[model samples]
Target: ASAKARLIDVFDLSDVQATYILDMPLRRLTKFSRIELEKESGELTTTIEELTAILDDDGNLRQVVSDELAAVGQQHATPRRTLLLEANASPAKSAVPLEVDDAPCIVLMSSTGLLARSADTEFDASADIARAAHDVIVSSVPATARGEIGLVTSAGRVLRLSVLDLPALPSVIGIPALSAGAPIGAFVDLPANEQALCLTTLDETGCIALATARGTVKRVVADTPGSKDSWEVIRLEDGDRVVGAVRLDDAAARTAELVLVTSDGQLLRFPATAVRPQGRAAGGMAGINLASGASVIAFGAFTPTDDAMLITIAGTTAALPGIDTGSMKVTPFAEYPAKGRATGGVRCHRFRSGEDLLTLAWVGNGPVRACSSSGVPVPLPTELGKRDATGVPVAAPVSHVAGSL
Candidate 1:
């Protein structure tokens, strides 16, 4: 009735008994009599022939048993456990009980009042091994509960703080001319050698602020207060005029150049450099009426219907097909009207990548529709909403106002 039960499982075998069962000389077992086998039924016994047969198999039986017993010993070995205590408790009385299948050779409490176990009897309670085990357990705790673990290094740095413990990032800093109390709306970093000017309406006074690498501070316009629609023109070193007023949404640098949309839906570019006082009237175009007149200027590759013409000092002229400028023929120096829309006002137009112009027309109360330069309608993003100065969606409930800067 010899069964395959492990030799160690059958009796309270000591380490020596296990070793003898696996490593005893095979010649000793072959001489055992039937009476001895009956007396030690569960004991290790084998004949020379049995040993030879086991050896002849693909795998040796004794070797297999030895390997299995070694694995079992390791599996049943006393495991190190750690128990973290509250910060207010003292280690002498606050140490928690550690449940284990086998008793450890040594047990000690950590500086954080955590219970630690080890197999070596000479194990130091403050040794690196115990500390390492304690640290592993504490580090694996959730970030929210890590503060309760009360574990710190010699240098006073917390051990288990995770990313969740860190505070949220601060908003981008250093905005120009932004009042300390005013909330920031938009921001943009100007290119090197580029200056951004902002026009702000403070206390009903038109104030101008220049943003350079040096700093952002406001300067009084010193000019006459005109209509809110009054524009500023600046002349560039390249002999081009940047026409338009500037409005600052945040401390970010913004150019003074603005695009004005007239009642007739004509777009014009007024450079910031060419702005100057013109008689009693201080408006853009320097008193130059471009409605019936034609001016050639280099404009962006794509322009909305609001930007119909660019009034630059340079001899560069670009056409914006988004705005139905009434069959206006775009020439080198002038844009002449070719045909006019039958009805309804022109809608906002935008240029896609390259020279592709997209015009969005608000025809009646239906959905805003878009069309290509060739009179072909195009699809737009479904999430289209009122965008802020930086093209981000504006929160619900918006208000529009007019003022000069």
Candidate 2:
């Protein structure tokens, strides 16, 4: 009664509430009801003590406020709507190029200008090509796996390719074969109707020699390494286009002979130095005067040491004697007197009765081997003979250059 009276006094209960409490039903004052009221009273007393304690210390009060705020935040939280990036994550104008270790590699280009790289210096001709049925290996070069390769197009432009950028192929049957590769047009923005003619490794120490179908030739200083932009290596006339490109050093240019073979079996050999080095954009000077219906088929720098072999399209192989380094006097096997530029070259091979043209010419110091278009080995006679001899025929036609990877 005293506790109830004190509560009513603290709450300022009116006379009507006091009367109601006095007139409470007897059922409302059961033992369970008394126990529930006692529990509620105890909870209220504990809450009052906690509130007093929190009010007594600033830290306790702040903690209570922080806890309430956290609870409210958790109940009302929503998912984020914007993403956050790193402080320096802005987009750039160009992508960074990749760096790789230098290793031996073979770069292959298809007839349709597709390009690929293999880790091996040699390819398995017997294995199936990693390209379409119509595509064939038109040009290839041995170079460092990470070196830069120059791609010459029929339009006389040179597009640069990093050997590392090419896809590497797996080795099968002891030789690596390019399984798949990107097209040259993807890396080079070639003009319409332009097609890739040849491929060569690029370096700063050498010069690039270009030969065109119309018998024009030019030697241009090689551009510095690491350039990705395509440049004009040779300027061509309306009807003329590049057919071949060779790398030559200053010393090699002085002694090495520039050999050009025509479709009619005519071969011209002259000092490479005869054609002075010109700028990349300069139109090349005449290299040979093509006969009325004859066209230049192949051009390369020939360093004669032991022999030069002429392989005809009809599969005839003839070995021509070269520099006789064995004798006390280094005598050439055949005296191909140096001629002025634009002169029709002397005969290199006498066409057989049925044979019409020559397809490949090789110059090396040691014995040479023949590889077929399908990667099989083709046998050749070991006999060394005089120049301008008729080539011995084989079973199949020689489609590409001998020893060209």
Candidate 3:
């Protein structure tokens, strides 16, 4: 009673509270709980001592922090994977060169509607390479790595494209494969039913000779205005479109002949001098006298000294295009004599049993490269047949053929 009175006096507690605290029963713990309780009590006592020492002096707090950091380093330290190096901080232009050196390259167009450039300028088309996708290069033009080239489209329009923006082909032996090239639509804003035909230079020294499906021929005067990126090279009729285009010079045209092959197996050959150069707005003159319902399929100029061979592939007119491989004939161009303009051409290929029209044709220097519609490499006849002979059935379907520059 006296001790309770002293506790109440020290804490200023009521007598009833002091009596309740004195009568409260203690909690009983199990064997496991007693050990846990003792552990918790020891941890709390140690924490309290450490905190009291930190409050007593600043050195104890620093020592605790240092011990914690050292524990963290021992627990989670790892070997370095990257090293820090010093570099000079300078202007961006000097730090990184943004200019491409002017090097000779070839701009190539695959038959599968792809465009790219390659640094393999000394490759020959006659040499064999691995048969990969887009193995056939239909058109190739010489250009610098940073120069510009022209893309001639079927709509008789030439679109200017920067060579630097073109995709570069990896260096390889023999002819380089252009499977990584971009599609023509990626760079040119082409319209529906119109596609790029070939490549040419945007210079003024040479002329652009082209032929239309309606037997029209014209040599466009290279009068490209300043800074003009696109221009119409020929004026077509209601249903006419350009089939082929080639760069020409006055010296080459004098000895060269413009050859046109119609779908009905008619081929007309005439000196390039017959068709004169005309302005862009002027409609072309008739270059061949076609039979009713016949249209020109191939038109190109070849020099007399060139080992030019006429390539014609005939397919069943009843079947869907590219569905059949058909037959191919390679006739030497020297066998065909020159004819006058506006005259019906001589028979170039005799039709087979089921063939009625030509599905593909080309007249240029051989040996040419052929590929299927799916960009697979195709083989051609190793023999040079007669001028008016029938072609043999090809081993595979050939959708396009190209001559090496």
TM-score of every model versus the real structure: 0.18, 0.55, 0.73
Off by over 4 Å in 1: 1-256, 277-405
What ranking of all candidate models by lDDT puts the best one first?
Answer: 3, 2, 1
1 or 3: which has the higher TM-score?
3
State the lDDT at 91 in candidate 3.
41
Cα TM-score of candidate 1: 0.18
* Sort order, TM-score high to low: 3, 2, 1
lDDT of model 3, residue 5: 94
**Among all windows of ten consecutive residues in candidate 1, which has the lowest summed lDDT?**
175-184
Give candidate 2's TM-score. 0.55
Give the alpha carbon lDDT tens digit for every residue of 217-251 in model 1. Answer: 12224243333323232222243322222222223
lDDT of 3 by residue, 1-405 (tens): 987898699889899988876676544325657889999999999999978989888888888889999999999984332222237645444565668789999899889888888888877656666666676777888889999999988999989999999888777777766667787877887888997888988767677889999999998887776688898988889989999988776577677789999999999989888988899899989999989989999988868556778899998778877678888998888888789988998999999998999888998886677888878888889998898999998998888887766
Q: Which scores better on TM-score, 1 or 2?
A: 2
Residue-level lDDT for 52 in candidate 1: 73
Whole-model Cα lDDT of every candidate shown, in order: 0.26, 0.64, 0.84
Error of 2 at 299 (Å): 0.6
Question: Which of the predicted structures, 2 or 3, would earn the higher TM-score when compared with the native?
Answer: 3
What value of lDDT does candidate 1 attain over all alpha carbons?
0.26
